[model samples]
Target: MDELEFRRQLYTNPRNRSEALLQEARRNNKNKKLYDDMQQLENKLEQALNVEVPDGLAERLMLRQSFDDSRQQYRRKSRWQIAIAASIAFALGLSTSLFHWQQQAADMGQLALQHVYEEMPYTSGVDEQPSLQTINAKLARYGASFEQLPGKVVYVNHCAYAGSPALHMVMKGKMGSNINVFVVPKSTELKTVQSFSDKTLHGMVEPLANASLVVVGEMKEPIEKTLHTLTAELNQAI
Candidate 1:
């Protein structure tokens, strides 16, 4: 098998043990890496598909079977029904996993941008507006600190992002709009400058070693320039 054939087999049935495909994959460096990555995904899918069986489930299922002719007919249908239930469960699990994985891959920056406005309703609380000391204190937990902000700090609060605890804040921007900054610690972020936008909000995510610094503001605002200056100040403080 050539590289394409080997890859086709890997994609379709990564567990295949055909010597020809396996030999070709091992011999080609590129094919080996592709095979490994695909295999890892396949393994994850397999693990996700696995369902835990209740204790004595097999015994309970067998107990429902009997040898009578009329009962045997029903028994056959029961077995078929059980198989269908298992298949449906497996299909649902796979679909849910795939949905979340696909969502996480598509437009992470856009999600950060949306989060800013989504939390606006709760902005009126007395403690919602926090001081610079409070902001840097939260940052210091993730091995980062800011002696000064690019603009006036208008709001600061500890919020949740992607099901994890994160530091959420807002700063005054040049265009009379508040910039939302969500800092998430011990979370995954893109290791590059990723920009995202919507009709009302625009944002970027800067991946850091211990946290992700996400910034969002109005679409017409100077995002790149402001982010650069803010990041520089943050680095200096650190």
Candidate 2:
């Protein structure tokens, strides 16, 4: 597995003993060390959770189990109780793993990319553009608005960003390329333009007033120009 996938797996489940993962770990000294370190941490955590039984609890339990019927029924009940406890523990562990992974996977740029493409095919550019009022209502939630859009406002709706629903817009670019705008109310820790590109899409994240705008589209589009226009209009609105 690649480093990102390997690290994610390690973070989620250090106790995992998959042969393929073991082989991947063994391929490089650094990877092996990383795996070993994670495993060591897991061991230490498990050790920390180990508890000693009370001194007289074992003898009292033995006396209770001395009777034949009680012993047999208690044995059956003990098994069932242990089984249910293990199932619950397993579920809790799985849920914790998923939540941890989701927290680690919080990158709004990637979220914007996925949302943009997922809606691209099903929704086309402005057959009948959304009214400015509709767009502003959604944008207002984030303290941003479009008094006048830079381009045709083909689609406008709300989509999730970091588990919270935010404004989503699809605008037709000057080059006829469709631009996706995701405006989420957030305070970015860094104050710089973040750009991303892939085989089929490219985009940049622009920090805004109490929010961020993610603009994405095909490579040929004048993405930078669109961004400037959008930013200017948004600044005026604020």
Give the runs in model 1 whose Cα sits over 4 Å from its true position: 1-72, 75-83, 86-94, 105-107, 124-129, 186-193, 236-238
lDDT of 2 by residue, 1-238 (tens): 6554465556667888888788889989988999999988988988865644344344433434445566678667656555555556668987999886565446666666776765665456344477878878877778877668667877777765556667778888888878888887774422334998778888998887688888998888879888898998884245
User: Superposing all C-alpha atoms, what RMSD in Å does each candidate have to the true structure?
Assistant: 17.9, 15.7
Q: With candidate 2 superimposed using the best TM-score fit, by how many Å does residue 159's alpha carbon deviate from the native?
A: 2.8
Q: How well is each residue in 1-238 modelled by candidate 1, as lDDT tens digits?
A: 6443465457557888789878978897888887788879888988975766444344444455555568668656666666666667678987999887657644557557656666665442323456668878877766777767667776776665655567777777787677788776644443334777778888888876677778888888787777777777784223
- Look at candidate 1 and tell me the lDDT of residue 124: 29
Q: Score each candidate by Cα lDDT.
A: 0.68, 0.72
Pairs with backbone N, CA or C atoms under 3 Å apart (clashes), candidate 1: none
In model 2, the clashing pairs are none
TM-score of each: 0.57, 0.57
Report the backbone clash tally of model 2: 0
